[model samples]
Target: MDEECSAFIDRDGDFMEVMCCDYGFRSGASRMYQQENDGRIPKNAFQLGWDNFKSELRSLRQSIRFDDYSTISEANPPRTPMSRAAYSVGQAALDSLDAVDRALEAAQVLEPLRPRAVTLDGVTRDSESGSKLINNCAEIRSKLKQLKLSNKAMWDREHAREQSGRGVETPWLIKGVYLSLCLLLDFLYENRPIQRFWFLETVARMPYFSYISMLHLYESLGWWRAGAELRKIHFAEEWNELHHLQIMESLGGDQLWFDRFAAQHAAILYYWILLGLYVFSPRLAYNFSELIEYHAVDTYGEFVDANEELLKSLPPPLVAAVYYRSQDLYMFDSFQTSQPMQNPRRPSCKTLYDVFKNICDDEMEHVKTMKACQDETVSQDIITRREDGPRVGL
Candidate 1:
């Protein structure tokens, strides 16, 4: 998922760089995948439309379809090919469905949790502060709803039954890409737990929501996947209501998949940090910080280059998705260096602050990995030049 929220928000530039790279690369991969399939398209959006397969289930021409894509606007502002395709698919699939409009699983508003603790670690806050956080959470969900709706429409418009466009022109590609982008944007909106467009009905219900959505989207687009899952889509407060792996891991559930087990498992850092908050009593702020640092440096660095080219070429819908991921990575890398493993107390416990550190650490590793991959490309170019030079000219 994300390394840390604040750091990610701050390193927007680094994040943007990574995102742009990821979208471009993924676009290439997706295009390759399409070519391999002889240009038809798939049901899900992986490497191209990885998360939800519906995006790729069209003609190859869909990639260039966003003619008037500028009309869309929501929190994230659709920016990748995947988003556009997804947007189109969402429209086709969602609209094609027989489900009632109110009953649709596409998006739903969640009731905000009134955190007894200012942070999840069991601390109290003044009424006004708590209310503010709750309101902010609501806002995040609302924005996400709009994003999802936009994508659904995008996909629908491009693939409209009446269109006779057989050529793979920009207009056609934009229509598909715009639709896919809309859906990708919607997925982000639904997947985010506390952010805009939080879908109440989604298994992205609690802490794992953000991670799972990210992982699924990454995999769907063939970018990368990581994180945890539960046995079934539905859940009850008491763990007994469902069937799960005997051990609390993802072994026996409804078969939740992960693209890269190691990278996605990186979420262990977040869980551990949360445990430190939820399960333990309040402690020194630095203690929490140290814990967060440990995870960031430890597991987060696992995926920086986990899926290089795939990550780089995300579609129009998912372009921003890659960007935010990179931006967060960049932000966390810097954030950890300064106040890492410190106390985040007004609440207490280094755990809270450290959680962010863990995330930052994860994103930074990605930054490192991406750079290494780029460097490798440069190095290869140099070697190629030397090889091409007059055969042992000396």
Candidate 2:
């Protein structure tokens, strides 16, 4: 992808415009803005509630006017009229609530009560680009269905591979939890590849967040400062995963309220579980993360191999291009412990295929880092990097 094509790269634009465009319509932009701008003004409870109410009312009206509940038929072919009506009402209500939540989230950065000068040029451009990518992916998915190359087929292949495991023995509890999560994903996201990936990315970042939280707590308590470098690497990994999540969101992976609810809740639960595990035994925590990272690699690898032609035909999302081809790649290189700093990955982001390929490669890097943490060699790697001095990639 041309660097200039990315809305985020070499673009002289307002912060709000860039936020709305690069992060799409979702809350990713709002969350990112809050992270970058720590001193952002906060909306009062009453004003925030009012904005949410207005947004929800608008969303409800749109849903009533436009939504036809087509997915109800696709999911349950023999639905009765009463059932369909119930589903429609329930779905519309849930969608409105989700819209309100997203609106309130955006208000965190946009200041709904304030008259901010916001430009929609980049937002419109990225929206069109994202729609094209989604449509291309849909056509490709239909083609895959015709060829019997379905998500279930991929899941079964991964299942068989899991049965014939190579290594990495974990406690029975960890193994059970991991297997349960995989099974849940297989069941919940049978034909929805993008949503499946969205949920996966949502949960995938939790381990790193948990690790970083624990490390931070340790430092604050003056209990352990040895993990200072490890905290940086974990934060870098989390940042990388956040971009992956945004890319999936740009592809409309988070349109459904139910999917959002499930993924976010699962992510929160996993984060705490991982935090507890880290408190007890950091090795075990790393082991669990290693398992999840390996699973992500397998899943993304299967996705890229199965949809290579279609993905290549589609353009990369603006978020993917910005992330993979950004001028500053210090965060990118930090998480990749297995690769030498001098020989860091400079991956292409010209197509959707390249994006997924890079994500798979990133997961592999996470796997290596997690294994290093488990084996207690990550500290040495950090020390080696320090000795070599910071690279000029940034």
User: 166-198, model 2: which lDDT tens digit per residue?
Assistant: 446799999898889888987676656777888
* Range of the 10 consecutive residues with the lowest summed lDDT in candidate 1: 241-250
Local distance difference test values of all predictions, in order: 0.28, 0.71
Global CA lDDT computed for model 1: 0.28
Q: How far does residue 148 in candidate 2 sit from its true spot (Å)?
A: 9.4
Error of 2 at 82 (Å): 19
**Per-residue lDDT of model 1, residues 301-379, tens digit only:** 2222332233233222222222223332322222111122232111111221222223334333333322322234423
In model 2, where do residues sit more than 4 Å from their true spots?
1-69, 72-152, 155-165, 392-394
Tell me, by lDDT, which candidate is best: 2
Stretches of model 1 off by over 4 angstroms after superposition: 1-127, 150-394
lDDT of 2: 0.71
Counted clashes in each candidate structure: 110, 0
RMSD of 2: 8.1
What does candidate 1 score on TM?
0.20
